[model samples]
Target: MSPRSASVNEELRRRSRERLLQATVELVGERGYEATTLADIADRAGAARGLVSYYFPGKRPLVQSAVHRLMHMTLSEALEREPVTTDGRERMARAIDAVLGLTRSHTTLMRMHMAGILQAEGFIQCPEQQRLAFLLEDTVTRYGSEQPEHDYRLLRALLMGAVVALLLPGAPMPLGSLRAELFQRYGLEWELGTPPQDEEPAPR
Candidate 1:
């Protein structure tokens, strides 16, 4: 083949691969990782099945890529909503508010992440998941002046669990009130007066 033709083909393939990744993230975020298939991603991305296979090798890689994209997007956006502070207590408070706001805004995406982790042990064991967990741990570790690592981990776990439970179906309480209580329990009483924002997280 001619060099010009080869270069054009390569560019097209690169664009197609990126589109597939984007489509996978959007579909997984909306439907779910398990529910979405290669066909669906191909259609959404305007790519061919053969091309997806060429780019991703298999479904696992595609899912992993999608998860990585989703996590990075969520974390980047979440980190931006509040100012960075050095004081551990203040930072922890801001982080709490940021994370809670992120969860509330992107319940569907958060649910997809939770569901993915629960259903697939291998998937959850991926390095991206480990990295994400470490990021959470690091954020919480900053608040460990008087508390032990175990205590901080426990508090973080409890806080995350409460948020999930409150968000799950058949919970008979108001989400707003429940989230407020959570923030207060975490010593973030300052966020109580802030109005709710309507920004949703990007799809998985």
Candidate 2:
């Protein structure tokens, strides 16, 4: 057969990167941030050990990218869930729910990611994070923001604050209350997006 085309090469590279990121998530989520090492992540990804150094500067960046990938995928799926709506308010509500849901479902991974962001390393600013921001910004625009740039930042700040509060070590806040506060800020109803499954049904 003829040599593979440039497109094929690019696709292969993409798959390799994705595998590494996915492996990072699996390893870190199962073992916690401190316990998972780059070698372990590369092994789980079935990639060469040197490839870890080639793809990421170190464990923190790899883990950050992995978590961003997870968050982006979660929000994307929530936005496109069954019976999708065109209403901006509903979309914004769903976005909030999706993020909070991640905190509950992936507490260990998300907590580590939050700590990484707040630490001296600061934000990773990787492709995965940019994609997550783009999706959330789109949600803010859909929410009928008069100034998307400003409103998106505000929405992101609120969400981050909520996530931090929810994941704070030794003092985790109530998930339902956090979700309700975000929903109230946007005038969203309780039954929007992926609402808290653990919450008791509200009485009529």
Candidate 3:
């Protein structure tokens, strides 16, 4: 093949791989990773299974690549966007709003993330899991003191807990209110707009 033709072929291959990866992300959200076979991904991408096998070789690697794509695409990068500052208070409010917005937007992917965690031991080990845990940790750690590592950890745990609560069969908890309460309990009071006004009674 001529050099120009080879370059065009390479570009097409790159696009094909990207489409396959995207297809995997969407399909995994619709049907959890376990239910999503290589054939399914191939069909969704409109490519043959041989092409998927050529690109990814196996199911686990494809899923791992998809997970990495998701981590970098949605969760990890959400915190790094340009800040709309109106002092620290507004920054904090914007941050919280951004976080909640990301959570809502990627609910399905988040569920697949949780499901992957639950079944992680089957085909995944500590290294991959720890990387993700630390990504979440880093995002939380951006908000406060160096000593607040534990607080960041707890906040992520609480966020995941809230997601699970909403996923349960029963009526969803007042998540917005519950999240606000959790934020207050963890020193997010001033960051999320002003606190409500109140008065105390005097003793007789």
Candidate 4:
């Protein structure tokens, strides 16, 4: 049999990496960060342990990238869902809600990822994160921003702060309050961006 072409090999590698990333997300979310290991991720992905090292320097980096991949996928699906609209306000609201939803659903995994980010490396500039950033930037631009660059930074900061607030230990803030503040910041209505059933979304 002929050897696989470079394109085929690259595609295989891409799929392999994606599987590992996905498995990491699942296991970490289910088992929390410290309980999940590279071995577990490799087994879940059905890939060899060596591949984990090849794809990531350590568990922290892999978790960060995996979470970013999840974020990108989550945001992308929300933006491209049925009844698509070109309205920037709607898109921005949807973006906020999508991220907020992820934080709520994957609180354990997201909290660990946040802890890792607060560690030495800060945030990894991985491809997944870049994709997430691109989508958010596009959302901000669509939201009638006269300064998309500035607006994107502000939106990202606000979203991060809200996520942190939601996941804070002991004194976690209400998701509705955080959501409301975000909606108000973008002048989004309570009904926008997968809004919850709460009457007040604003932070008290």
Q: Could you say which candidate leads in lDDT? A: 4
- Looking at candidate 4, the ten consecutive residues that score lowest on lDDT are 195-204
What digit string (tens of lDDT, one per residue) describes model 4 on residues 21-113? 999999999999889989999999999999999989999989999999999999999999988988888898889989988877899988998
User: Compared to the true structure, candidate 2 yields what TM-score?
Assistant: 0.93
Clashing pairs in 1: 29-204
Q: What is the per-residue lDDT of model 2 for residues 1-204, given as tens digits with 9 covering 90 to 100? A: 335787787788889899999999888889999899888988998999998898889889989999999999999988888888878988998899888888878889999888889999998889999999999889988888888888888988899999999998899888888888777788888887767777733333
TM-score of each: 0.60, 0.93, 0.57, 0.94
lDDT per residue as tens, model 3, 1-204: 999999999999988887887898888778777788899988999998899989775776676666555554554444445543334333344434444443456566555655555574333433334555565555555555365568556765676576666554456554456556555655665335322233121222
Which parts of model 2 are misplaced by more than 4 Å? Answer: 1-4, 200-204
TM-score of model 1 relative to the true fold?
A: 0.60
The candidate, 1 or 2, that scores higher on lDDT is 2
Q: What is the lDDT of residue 32 in candidate 4?
A: 94
As for lDDT, the candidate ahead, 1 or 3, is: 1
Q: Between which residue pairs do clashes occur in model 4? A: 88-142, 180-201, 180-202
Model 1: per-residue Cα lDDT over 57-125, one tens digit each: 667667766665556455445544555454545555554555555456656656665555455533434
- Best-performing candidate as measured by TM-score: 4
